[model samples]
Target: MIDALSPLLILLAVALPLALALAAALPAFRARALDLLPFAPLPSLAAALLATEGARVGVPELLFGVRLELRGEGRLFLGFASFLWCLAGLYARSEMRGTQRPTLFAVSWCLALAGNLGVFLAGDVVTFYTAFACLTFAAYPAIVSSGTEAAYRAGRVYMVFSVAGETALLAALMLAASGAVSLSIGGVSASIASLPQRDVVHLLLLVGFGIKAGLVPLHLWLPLAHPAAPPAASAVLSGAMVKAGLFGLMRFMPGDGALGDAWPLLLLALGLAGCFYGIAMGLTQTKPKTILAYSTVSQMSLMVALLSAGLGEGAAGAAFGALSLYALHHGLAKGALFMGAGLAPLARPGARIGFLALLALPALSVAGLPLTGGALAKLAGKMPFSGAAETLVTLSAAGTTLVMLRFLAAAGSQAGSGSERLPAARLAPMIAATLAAVALPWWLFPALSGQDLGYVLRPDNLWSAAWPVALAAAGFLVWRRAGFPAPAVPPGDILVPLTAALERLRKPWAAIHYPPFPKRRSAQLRARGMKVLLASERGLLSWSLAGPLVLAVVLFAALYRP
Candidate 1:
């Protein structure tokens, strides 16, 4: 009975959200769709809690025989991701009330939720790519939901990077699939390491997933997107969606460390660079959300470094549990911070102190304060590091702390500037997310790390976590005394100069006009055909058409597979 039920749960996890999204796309249910948003992720949450590890369901009729499974790390990823999505959905319903294009936002939310959950449960390469594509395309509407110029610009940037990443991933997948014995993700991952073009495959995978994970230089989309999106959307964008790239890396990269020394060393170098670069850039930003976005870049880079260390030592299998724990801790805590930022402006003057204190809990946890989940996560990640690497990892906590302090100050300054009282609907989700961030890691730490609470509480371990936060606090005080002398670096630091250069070139190019060519029958025919193709492409790309098409495909796979 248990075995039979597990597969059903897995099927429902992906199906439920797709079904809701389909309903949301209809005219009759469009207005009520947002009301049902909170319920869409429930099936995924249930699957995460009850599905047995190693249990899988296969749908052979689907593209290249789709498979869904729950493994140890996948289960943990699903659980935390589902939890974040559910809460974020509720927050969205509350925050986006009376906002423009409610139906579009609702459909996008459900489709993106389905895709995010599906990525965790996908057991085959095709299914994984399908889900990833669904997520990448569906999330664009949410980024531009505000309908502002900045929002549209951010959406465009997000799409350009997402398309590039997906294209790279598709090429890599095609090469890997050609050499594998089966289409299973595990099989393909194992075979890729032995393929003749292994080096090329590895580079493509890293560059593809690295974009989504906000690795340096390629991470310009994140800081822009987060600030432009609604609070709930930003929460999931930063908290859960970015994890898709990390998940992709973990799933596709060989666990046996067949990536060779160059790949691991290069990854390590990039990770270390991003860790500090995010901090340096984050310090110059004024917006709380942008600061948090850069913080994600740092934290995610640190995780990549941890993964690289494991690969270098041929112990990636051992590193998986630690990476999952760190990801979970960061996801929940960061979600809380983003939600808190949304709620801050609504706080009454009398409640300001309580709000700040609430915000600080997750911030400190993120900074690795003693006994918090972040500390345990930090400790687990440090297991594979030593000497200079360990010290640098520890010092990063100080940088994270300084950034968190900046975020707290920015959040506090916005209090009482909006409505006189905070709405319970909005307040409840942030508080719940905050408490979960603090509590869930403790519950899962022993299972993920194989170490008891006492080990985390040891005197040496406590000291390791405390000193960096202390140093950061002291440094923050000193910096505050000096009135924050750092010059303001514009958000999307590299993008600013690059955009200016392009604009300069565009003006000169536009000034030099060419004479019109003589019209011919063949040229007219070709032009007409091109216009027809472009029109069809635009229609297919619109949410009204694309959302249902994706849902229809997944629904058919779920119901028709023998």
Candidate 2:
């Protein structure tokens, strides 16, 4: 029975949410779409639980033969990502109630859910790229759903980075597919080592995916987007969506030493830099969501560093398991934390203490407190490193602790500020995610790490997890006592300066106007054509048309290809 159902499950996992998103396009279904949000990811979650590894469903006529397959790593990614999306969807159902643009949010949410889950199950280059592009364009509306200037600004910056990243990824995928006999991701992976332009492919993949993973310098969109988006949107943006890039890197990059040591070393260096850079910038922020966004930057960098270490030492197999485990741990904990931030303002004064305590569970888990899933994840992440590198990773926990501590403080202060009472619909999803963050890793640790529960609970292992958090807690108290002697670095730290520089450059260019075009008969005809093209361009660039226009172009390209 399970065998017969596997292919159906695989197809439904991607198809169901997509179907709902299309239904949402109708005027009759528009208002009802919000009610369907929680159900959109059910097929994906069911597939994650029931589909056998390596089970696949393929379509010979779709986008040069599209396929969806379940591998060990992909299964793990699919499971957690689907789980997070489901809970986040529930949270959004409550959080977005009676908002200005329910239809838009509901449609974008369903489409992004489909695309996010599709990336893990995608078996071919075209399928993966299509899913990725779907996710990239679909998420823009949610980012700007608040209809605030800040939200709009963040959405603009997000699009700029997203477009550039997508362009690089498309070029890289085309190059990778050029040398492969089959269109399957596995086929491309097998041929990557022998490709003539493998080095360039690696570079493009890193930059393209690095932006999504929130790596340093390329991560400007995250801090801004998180603060401007709705809490549930922020949850998936940090927790589940960012993992798409890490998944892409893991899937596409060859670990066979084909690209030499320089790439891995460069990755390692960038990761380490982001680890510290995120901490430094996070400490200056007061918004709970912004702080969590920077925390994501740091945690993701650590995972990337671990991957680089594994690649450098030829232990990529073990690293893959550890990376998946770490990603799952972070996704649940961070999702819970972001939702908790939304719930904080609704807590009654009488229940404020209890609310903070509940919020602290996921926050502490993110800091790698002993007896939590994060402890197991941190231990697994450490398995690939030794010497100074391992020590640095261990100490980074202290930084995580400080940032999480700040989140708790910020959230606590915001508690009971909303006029409305807290509802179970809003609270239940956060609580469920919190419980999963603390409990699920213990159940899965043995399978992923090949170690018994006793190993994680051993005195030495407990001490390794406890000390950094303890030290950081003490430091946080002292810093609080000393009045937090840090400068106020704005969110999107580097973007502020870069924008100012661009404005300065633009002022000079604007002042230097060129002469008008000659008025010959041929020039007049050409000018008329230019006017028509410019008007069309302006129409396509409008906010309402941009996202769907891009989605249409991507789908057209995918379908038009052999």
Candidate 3:
């Protein structure tokens, strides 16, 4: 099946971007290439849809056996992420219309798009690594394109973390591959749980992918990086690129609960911590993008927790299903939010209300409002948890609601100077993305779960989803009535201490130059002996003294140690 669709997958996974890149090389095409960026991802979207049945494309000689495969999970990931890329590209052409260095931006977009799509389709370790590398490195330029000081700092932090992540992933992959018969993702994943160094490999892979997933302690780059990038870039960064880390986790780790490793529990703890941590930190942020960034942290944490719990319970199939649905919902919703952040400010007052309505659809959905994509996602992911764990999962929706409300407040504050409505380029994509977020789940749920829409629409499920959002709304009202000011936690909250510690160490280290060892009498005597030894060394090299020395060494070796 994979072999049969290999050609089309190759076109979507590799050839489309290569062609765009080639076209970008010509000056005639380069001038207007930004306009064409939105379309570059269309092929990928098509392939993702067509290849839902599954496909594999590989060439043994290409970059250590480059191979691309699309199964159900990969297909869903590809379809959703590719959809985001396409919409973000549409948003970008207008968002970045008069921006500097358009050509550089266009090239980066194309490269990153290809890499992002390739990751979902990747079948082998080498192929996945290549795709991950492309996505990671190619995104650097996009992040720093603003040329702001903050953008530069964000890019630096992002690259530092990215390099560290790649290094860890490479090590983990090498270890996993060493014990595997085949280097494909499935083969490596199957072998990982049984490796002698499985724990170490697991840790490395977790930290490696966790950094990309924006898990706490390793998530400092996200708030800074997301806000620093253009809205379109932020959309992909939050919506699609970050999902790569989650994909890595699913691909490399054992999800079947059969591994019997303690790592899954640890992952669950990290995920739970991140879920709350992101909410606490996000509320303190004043920027819409930063709020969204932290929101991503919170959201992905739930995913990490879900996947980890699934692994612990040995329900790999169920875990992947939940992750797929959740990711699809998030990719579209978050992408729409980021784009709407940009569009909201540009929209006229009369039209802005409607735009805000559009924005709220996804925002509320993200908070698990009943009948929305988020509710479907939340409900679908509810399978792994029961008892208290399940309650905690449902209540996390309140935190999401708070974050969404905050995002709206922040975005609304940036309304443009003119009373003009949103431009078609921006408005069209935002509307499309939001609608997709709302409607896609209904269509996809049946296919993915073999369950009807009625499951999510059930009264109990709707109630489970609604109360958290309602609680959050009430909490917001109380907080507003009390007039409590939001604390101003800076973006990259934990990074401040780390930076200060580095700065504090800088002068102390610079002040202390190592002095030459004290020239005591013993030292002078040792130096004299060293000079005599050096004088003998020259004669030894001349083969005069060397013959006796060589013979002495041979005799010593023959005598051996007592």
- TM-scores for every predicted model: 0.92, 0.92, 0.89
Worst-scoring 10-residue span by lDDT in model 1? 547-556
Give the per-residue lDDT of model 3 (tens digit) for 1-562: 7456655765566668857866876798988979778888887787776654656666777887778777758888988898898899988998887889888888888988888888888888988988888999999999999999999999999999998888778778877998999988889999987898988898889989999999987999999999999999999999999999999898888765656757777887888889989998989998888999999999999899888866866477767888799999998999999988877667776675666677888999899899888888888888778887788788788998999988887887775434876789888888888999989988877665546887877888889898899999999889978989999999999898889999998988899988677669768899999999999888779775575457547545754888
For every candidate, C-alpha RMSD to the true structure in Å = 6.6, 5.6, 8.7
Give the C-alpha lDDT of model 2: 0.89
Best lDDT goes to which candidate? 2
Across 398-450, the per-residue lDDT of candidate 2 in tens digits comes to 99999999999999999977766688887888999999989999988888876
Better of 2 and 3 by TM-score: 2
Clashing residue pairs, backbone N/CA/C < 3 A, model 3: 2-55, 2-56, 256-314, 257-314
**Among all windows of ten consecutive residues in candidate 2, which has the lowest summed lDDT?**
543-552
Residue 431 accuracy (lDDT) in model 1: 84
Query: Candidates sorted by lDDT, descending order?
Result: 2, 1, 3
Q: Give lDDT per model, in order.
A: 0.88, 0.89, 0.85
Off by over 4 Å in 1: 518-524, 527-562
